[model samples]
Target chain A: MNINRNNYEAYFISYIENELNNTQRKAVEDFVAMNPDLKNELELFGATKLEADEKIIFADKESLLQKNSTKIIAWKWNINVWASAAILLLLLGVGWWMMNQSAVKSHQFSEEKINVKSDSVKSSELRIRNSELIKTEKHYLAKNNFAKTKRVENKNFNAKIILPETIDTAELPNSWTSRKKWNEEHEIHVVQEIKPEEILQVQKNVAEIDTIKAVAQNAISVPPTKKTEEKMIAQIPFKTSKNERQILKMLAWASSKVLGKETNNGNFDVSIGFAEISHKQALQDN
Target chain B: MTINDYNFCVTAYADHLFRFIFKHTQHEENARDVVQNAFEILWKKRDEVEMEKAKSFLFSVAYKNKIDQFRKQSKVNLVDEFSAQTKIINEHKSGLKDALEKALNTLPDIQKSCVLLRDYEGYDYKEIGEILNLNESQVKVYIFRARQSLKNYLVSIETVL
Candidate 1:
């Protein structure tokens, strides 16, 4: 369209709306440049268009959706927090249980050590008693002249007896001759002189023997023949007879005397044998 | 699009659609309902809607719902008329911007919608035509008439001031 004064308003409005074609836009621009008075009107129209746009703003969606959006966020946050707390609690429980188990194990270990030490001490005392009993048995065999006589009477008797070779018999004091004389004179006296403590020690030895028998029975894979059991019993010459009882009492008294001297001021001199007469008297008392 | 893409669309275009509807309806509740309904429709057809076309789809749905709202009311909304009257009464006290707003209210609903789509959203005439269910030329005519009304209001205000 031609941009004359009458048509300029339509072209200027179209130009402001960006509706004018290039030729129409040029025509409008030329007319506006020539008439500077129309420029202020165009500026006012542009400002009004901008202001009208500013007036019709949409409500902020972030503010509008704040309640729902925050709720969703809080729900997710709560799940995360709870999950973390649960894992932490589980770890703490596992740690506490492991610590308690270790403490119990250590306590048990210490108790085992104390029991082992006491067992070793008991075993040592039993060794000393065993050595004394073997010595007493040898003396009874010699005095009664049974070692040679029993071999002929019991044809199944084995001459070889298995003794712990660890104990040196030569280290024992030569009080066996006087012990025989004391026995001949006071065989009954020895049984009467046996102390209660010695009797308790004998009972402990009996219990230990029973335990060993039980362990052996559990360890054996096969049952022994009746003949083998009989042979095993016949090999041991020590029977539960009156003479064997007297022998046990005499051995107990001798062990007590030896242990008493050793315990007193810790003196363990084995050669003195106290006095041969006092030994004879102890045998008489036995 | 996936549900994720639909959710993205809601966050991205919800405010823009709401603004367009709110400007057309001049009622906050109606605009919110229209935007929400538009999103619901988008979600229902999410499998068919593409991510790039989501903005156009949302605006189209919101615009249709806004038109339906205007049809449902049938009677002219006195709120807009009252606001325009108050704006004109206070025209001398306000700037050319206030006068232009009053003039915008004076235009036909279709013209006002087309002009706003053109000026405010910076949509081309063809795009505005698509949104308002008009041809490109028709969109151009609505915008030109709307701007002419605005310019006249500004001049009258300036002469009064």
Candidate 2:
């Protein structure tokens, strides 16, 4: 701790800074007092210790802090906003999916209801037609016994009516009915001498009946046999005398040519007959 | 560090950091720039810097920026130094404080920073070394040399007076 002349520079710095203990401080003071040359040097070194100027101050203190905090807040806010937007989009997607599912379900339900209604309407029509057909057959059976039933074949008629060999008719109808019904039952076999207009009308009525029955039955059911029967009946028009039938057949054939081309299944024979009549005058001119 | 701790650092150490940088840089705008940059760095790394070590961190950052500024202005400083010398020579005799300020400009940048940190801020040799990125012995030597130079400059001025 003794401050010698050789090591006095180190002690002088320490002593001026008040870093020395009491014993060392006293030793340095004693040494400086003894050496007049080192005293001025130590005083000059002390003058270098400058006080901080009050004018040298940071002016904009809060701006840096404010800018930093604002950036952090903005980053956090952006993350929150994006998360909320994503959640909202997900909710909208789920809602849209649910709505689409309900729409499909309602559409199927309505289709099923329409099918049910159509089936009921078709069944009622079939019942009424079947009853009428049975009554007509019974009346014909009674009349077949009273009259001498003649079996005549017409090649033009495609439907072959195979009658029973003997009619065991316990019932008899002696009264006469309308000519239209009689004509319908026996025209193709016995009464082969009908007017051309009457024959054409009969063929037209037959086509219309077939069309109505086929449409009603085929609307919901797929009975292949009924469809074939409808087509055959529609194709075969009633026949008369050879010359008259030939003229009518020629006329029918000519009219049928004007019908649009037949379907692939040949199911449009009825349209051919009407097409033939409308073009008859043109045919005669030709 | 929390917000409150960061604010405390700003309030407590801003002026001290500014004075330290100003002494080294000698230009008010450069010193202010260094102080602001240091605070900005502190705020960005607040989570990593401890509340107690914030003052040390600010000083270290400011010291580094002051050196960078010096490097950028090195060419300009050479020209300015001549003008500054002429001004000092022609100026009227001021107090010891003005003489000390002129004397500080004569020291090298490292020596000036070391001496300023030691004398103005009262940082010990180890602390000064940490701020200046030097070893304790290097900081000690720089401060010693700076003080000797200041002493010589002051004595010559007094002789002229």
Candidate 3:
């Protein structure tokens, strides 16, 4: 009954495992068979071992078993849906910008045509107003000529020339008095017929006024006044027939002070006159 | 090995490996997943695995898979439901079974696994060593210590009673 510690340990484990050599296995079997204490110990060990194993083996069925692949597939679907939503949002944003740009372009396109039409209508109105003013001027000139011819025919010219009893013409300038006396002595007769000489005179005046008015309109969009233009023109380098070198020397000196060292012969500054407020102001400045 | 060889491995070892993992993990679902993943990995690498060594291969795969699962789940520190489970089983136990279970849960994980492989599965020292990734001597020591711990705990409970 007394087994050594080492042998007992070996036998204890081997006996429990049922892995002893034939003879050794039989010996331990016989010993446990005869010894009740050893048998009881074996039984307790066996029971404890089995209970522990059973508890471990008693796993929850749901936790151990793999669930269906549906949950994982659903996660994949979530990523796909979000990606599609982002793409859709980007497309919508681009489409909205394109639509707004198109609308603005179309609005500007229509506005340009309306502006062009309004400009043409304004020019036509100006032409009509000019013609009306010309017609009124012609009517006033014809009536004055008719009245003057009637006075000459009725011998009433002297009666029309009746002077004031007192003369205090000192206040009037000599230029104004001379102009008035000339007008009284000679009638300015405008012939109703289309005379070639009269047409030539009118054409010369028209050419001057027309060119000046065109220049004035062009310079109205610019900054300075007509006096500046005349001053600039008077300062242009011109040589008389007498001494070209002297004129040139004078011009060079003047230009150095005025036009600086811009001595290039081909370079010329053309000055165009532009009017400002009134005829009286124009004469006063001259 | 072809997929057929892989499938054969699955049919042969899946249930056994699942049962083995179930015993250790004590959760049927975790056991199933561990086995399935082990087989899946084996299937993926069928070309590399020898058909003859399929059992050891599956067990090793299952072992690694189970360990990884245990470690991952441990991160959240799932409340040790084992204590509550022992409490419930304790109420139903008429005798030493209650004391034995409480003592078993108290043992360290390796020692408990070592004892379970030896006693319940009827594995020898070498077999337990292979299952637990321990040497025979280490397995022996673990089992002895585990049994001594259980015995001490049970005796202590008796003294208290």
Per-model DockQ: 0.13, 0.24, 0.07
Model 1 Cα displacement at B127 (Å)?
0.9
Q: Per-residue lDDT of B29-136 in model 2, one digit per residue for the tens?
A: 666678888888998899999997899899998877666756556335432332322222323537777899889888888888887787778899899889889999
Please tell me which predicted candidate would have the highest lDDT against the true structure.
Answer: 2
Q: CA lDDT of each candidate?
A: 0.51, 0.55, 0.44
lDDT of 3 by residue, A173-256 (tens): 123223233222222121212233333343242333343334323322332233432232233222222222222222222222
Candidate 2 segments whose C-alpha is farther than 4 A from its true place = A67-79, A86-286, B72-93
Cα distance off (Å), candidate 2, residue A22: 2.1
Model 3, runs deviating above 4 Å: A5-10, A29-36, A51-286, B27-29, B68-102, B119-124, B150-161
Best by TM-score: 2
TM-score of each: 0.43, 0.51, 0.38
How well is each residue in B7-38 modelled by candidate 3, as lDDT tens digits?
A: 56655555556656655565545665687777
The better candidate by DockQ, 2 or 3, is 2
Best by DockQ: 2
Question: CA lDDT of A261 in candidate 3?
Answer: 26
Q: How close is candidate 3 to the true structure, as a TM-score?
A: 0.38
